[model samples]
Target: MNLESPKVNVTKSPQEVFNFLEDIKNFKSLMPENISKFEVLDDDKFLFALKGMPEIVLKKKEVIPPNKIVLGAAGGKLDFSLIGNIVETADGNSEVQLEFAGDFNPMMAMMIKGPITKFIETLATNMPKAI
Candidate 1:
């Protein structure tokens, strides 16, 4: 399954936004209010648990400076990835979009689509203030 957010503009420059995201600790500001727990495991990983879901381990998989950040699940229970795209605007501001992709059986996809969509959408919308 694949989900994507509408591109949104942020007042910050791409480099500034990228810098904030490069530091895993800054992710808490972008999490949903329902998140029950969030912790940075190290420079490239973080663990979080939502109200009714199991803890998910996310590892920073790839980075293309000032442009992209790729995060994916670890520990093998689920296979999913979250990609953040940042583009510099003519005015030096930034436009950001988020893509969420998961490999799951049809039944599993049906069960989690709603919550997953809400999660990524929330992140994208919160980006303007997250940095």
Candidate 2:
């Protein structure tokens, strides 16, 4: 299953946005106001817990300069990725979007899709504040 967030424009350039997101410690600014817990495990890893959800360890899986950052779940049995895609805009700003993808049993996908989509959308809307 896959869910994409609405693209959001930020005042910073793509490189700046990417630099901020590449740091695990900066993720807290992108999380919802209701975020219950957050911790930086290392340069490429962090742990966060949202209301009503299990604590999750997000480990950076790949980095593509100013374009993309791929993160995966570290401690859960679930197989998924949260991909941040960035593009330089005409106004010297950046356009950011988030994609959430997972391979799950159809039933399981159906069950959690709504919550996951909502989460990603919230994160995307908060993208302008990333830098």
Candidate 3:
């Protein structure tokens, strides 16, 4: 399954946004308010538990300077990647795009589609405020 969030324009520059996301420890600021627990395991890894979901560990997978950042589940049931693409605007601001891809069985896909879609959309929408 693949999900893409709407492009969002943020007041911060692309480098600023990319720098913020490059650090896994700053992810807590982007999480939903319902998150129950958050822990930073290292500079590149973190664990977080949502209100009703099992704790998930995420690790930074790749970085493309001020252009993109990729993250994946460290050791979890779900095999997924979350990618952030940043484009610097002429006005010195930034446009960000969020993409999520995961492998799942049909039943699991049906069960999670809605929540997962909403989660990604929420993340994209709130990212501007987070920076």
Candidate 4:
């Protein structure tokens, strides 16, 4: 099944939005209790634990300045990727989009997608406040 990605609007500039989301440490604050063992690998990669269900190790895959981020999780029935992007709006607002894609059983998809979407929305909305 195709996963639905959510877009969130934030009252922040593109540069500001980019810098904030690029840091792995920020992810810890956005997760619900299921996640544990969040770690930053060097300056580019991140390793973390997925909470509940079929727990797995998640790694940051790609980082593009002021625009895109990609994360992947593996080690279980679910092998998925989480992508996020931030763009500047004309009126000085920022638009952030979070997308999920993978090959997983329907049951696993149904269970994890919603919470991940919600987490992305919450992160995009509150990220500015953090900076």
Regarding lDDT, does 2 or 3 come out ahead? 2
lDDT values of the candidates?
0.90, 0.91, 0.90, 0.68
lDDT of 3 at 85: 95
* Cα lDDT tens digits for candidate 1, 49-121: 9999989999999999899999999886799999989999999999999999999999999999999989989
| Model 2 vs truth, CA RMSD | 1.0
lDDT of 3 by residue, 2-92 (tens): 9898999999999999999998887888888888999999989999888998898889999998999999999978999889999999899
Model number with the top lDDT: 2
Candidate 1 lands at a TM-score of: 0.96
Worst 10 residues of 2 by lDDT: 122-131
Clash count of each predicted structure: 0, 0, 0, 1
- Colliding residue pairs in candidate 2: none
Kindly give the stretch of ten consecutive residues in candidate 1 with the minimal lDDT sum: 19-28
- Which of the numbered candidates is closest to the native, going by highest TM-score? 1
Model 3: weakest 10-residue lDDT segment is 115-124
Task: Flag the better candidate by TM-score, 3 or 4.
Answer: 3
Q: What is candidate 2's lDDT per residue for 1-131, written digit by digit as tens?
A: 99999999999988999998898898898898779999999889999999888889999999999999999988788989999999998999999999998899999999999989888999888878657
Kindly report which residue stretches of model 3 are placed more than 4 angstroms away from their true locations once superposed: none
In order of lDDT, best first, we have 2, 1, 3, 4
